[model samples]
Target: MAKRRITQETFDAAVRENMEEFEMASEEALREAVEQFESQGVDLTCIVKAVAAVSSEDTPEESTHEVLQALDSLRIGDNSASVTEVEADMKRFTEHCLVGFAQRFLAAQKDAYPVILSHCKKSVEEPEALVNALSALAALTNGQPDLLEAEGKQLFLDVLKKHREDPSVTCVAVRTVRHCCLKHEQNRQDLVKGGVLPLLTGAVTQHSESAALVKEASAALRVMCYDDDIRATFGNAHEHAKSIVLEHKGLKVLIQAAKTHFEDTSVLSELCATLSRLAVRNEFCQDICDLGGLKLMMTLLADSYETAELVRQVLSALRALAGNDDVKDAVVNAGGVQYIVIAMNRHMNNAAVCEQGCGCLSVLALRKPENCQVIMENGGALAAVQAMKTHTNSLNVQNQACMLMRNLVARMPQYSQPILDMGAEALIAQALLTHQYIADVGKAALRDLGCQVELRELWTGEHGSLSY
Candidate 1:
């Protein structure tokens, strides 16, 4: 072996030459070189010499272009050179080469992304290449989604449209959808119209699809459903109402699935959440109530701990159906009042779920006075009263519990005395001191207990320590 000492001048010249030769390097040669370098513990000086030697060119312009060309070609599966050959070139001697290569490719060719998408979809069957290609798409679109040109978008749509039938590909495609679209309104519409739904739905039905991918799709759907105008524009809300509630018997599928696949919280959460929203309409509510929605929601509350959204969904459904006597009794029968009370007071858990459960319990109290006893027995009165007093700082919790308390005392006046004796009035009065909106709620609950505090009465000292 010739012992060669590498100088800065020698290093630069060798790197420049390697860059030129990179365009002609075989993937096989590259891999072999990589293997050799790894086995022998490659010298950094040798790598620099090789790169400069490979990139050396007769002209400066040609040298830079060839170096960029070689760097760009460092991507997977070229047979003419050893991967080690290319990696050593870039890893030790050519990071600037990598950035310069990427930037030049991005700037010089608007078609670069589409080419990358093509690789992700077709050029590379290897999962590693597919992953890398998808990653590149993510980085390119992270801040400049518009960087995904029309051709690239169509390329992505084409690749994912059919090939995503494979679970791995489908999962990757779901992620790509987020990156490629981000917040682009038109891109989102393209996904809906381009048959992304059926593919997603197909993947959703497949037990083998990753929990994460299904969850991501569910999240996207949840957002889409929230925008009533968008749903109306796409006609998805109508589909939601029709499928989940009525004509097609969709809820049956979920209930059946739940019996066997209880372990998959993602499945149950998405199904229950969808059912909750659909059940908000009057006809849908009656339909869900008829279909044992109460039992299923209770099951979700008791058995699932996947996400707080699942808990909130069950609570929301309970509240929607609370006007029905059967629904309220079902809630009490299901041990909902006790669980909800624990959630609010002792659990100090998710604030959203706590408020929703309270709303449902309040509604239950209004429909069935019998259920009111459950609330009291489970410390519901104390929780509600405490919410009125201590949560004056949190408007959402205060407003929700106060509204529920008003309903509780209004329907079951017999419980009002105990509720007041629990310091309900003190809590209500505290809230009244801050926000006028809930001031009426405090007064109303107090009034229901036959102890409305008139300022004049306070001055008279006729009523001592009367609380809501």
Candidate 2:
């Protein structure tokens, strides 16, 4: 039988009663409330499991957070008479939600979504209040994505359409859209069908100079490409990614945005990562190369060697683009191999850079012997070996390293001695023993490199018989 569950409000109210009526300590009250609820077979997994913050002394109300107080203020006001107080009330609510996740979760349990969204509907004509209301909504929906259902999501799109020219309002509105659509597949599809891709890219184009707006808008655009809703069965992530590239020209918009914020590594990282996500097709990869994305990526890689995050993202984009045969050659011809090696050597301690760097080489050297020579000549093999040795704890780094090693020696077996001389055998063997999942690739890498590897058979042509 299924145990019954109680609302968070009920549990919190009981805790407050314990603290106020029995004059118990906050800790004792919380423990007692938890014990009492469980004794009655009421599940409390969804509850926040904490005492409410004390209300300010001047209020003389029951103990409540400032966020809830502000919520009550807006709930009791007459829409026509309290127009002026909406902005301040929304700002106050937004500030409290920003304090932490617990506050946001608590506020959501108190039905803050409709209360705050009502302000968004009422203040559409007032820019300041609208922005404040949108900002508050964005914050309140941060961890509570289910709050943005049919009505809330439509209002979000409507806000974007109504305030298209207002960058300030659009920035917060896009942010709100991102927060709501994060784990909700239905919201993502609905927003995309409502022309959100164009609005997001247009925001990037219109506010190219505003890093804040571009960052928010770019993040929202990337969120559209996610297929993260667990309930979805084979989600529309690929279709959405294709739409952003074909229907909306996402590649050109993101690359141009990266150029505008070239000096800003933070923005460049976001844009490059987005570009990688959008590179879902072979022609799209070529499109990125033709659109000067390769040049921009190389330049960023060269200039941002010291910035581990930017370097990691650039290498990731390069790795994605190199999926095309032509782009692989183009990457090698443009001195990309050497740049990647240098970045890996520079940020050897950063597991992500090393992993992505090895992945780039692994892709570039796939079935292309000439590109393999370029990778080996440019210290690609040595960088990968060092990465394997440095980040022994990182399975991704180890896996990518083994894969790169396999690619390097797969076509050109002559390079095997030098790689072995670099002490790859020990690392590869240790990795094969340490991690079970990498056994297939790691064993294949060892075998191709002319090293002795154990091969096991699990089945034979005997009825009802298994062998290991």
Tell me the lDDT of candidate 1.
0.57
| Candidate 2 per-residue lDDT over residues 162-225, each given as its tens digit | 8888999999999999999898888899889988899899899988999999999888888888
174-233 per-residue lDDT for model 1 (tens digits): 666655555455565566666555554555556333566565544444433333333234
Q: After best superposition, candidate 1 residue 47: deviation in angstroms?
A: 37
- Root-mean-square deviation of candidate 2: 4.2
User: How far is 293's C-alpha from truth in model 2 (Å)?
Assistant: 0.5
For model 1, give the 10-residue run with minimal summed lDDT.
45-54
CA RMSD for every model? 14.9, 4.2
Query: Which regions in candidate 2 have their CA more than 4 angstroms from the true location?
Result: 1-62, 78-84, 461-468
TM-score of 1: 0.59
For model 2, name the residue pairs that clash.
Answer: none
User: Highest lDDT: which candidate?
Assistant: 2
What are the per-model numbers of colliding residue pairs? 42, 0
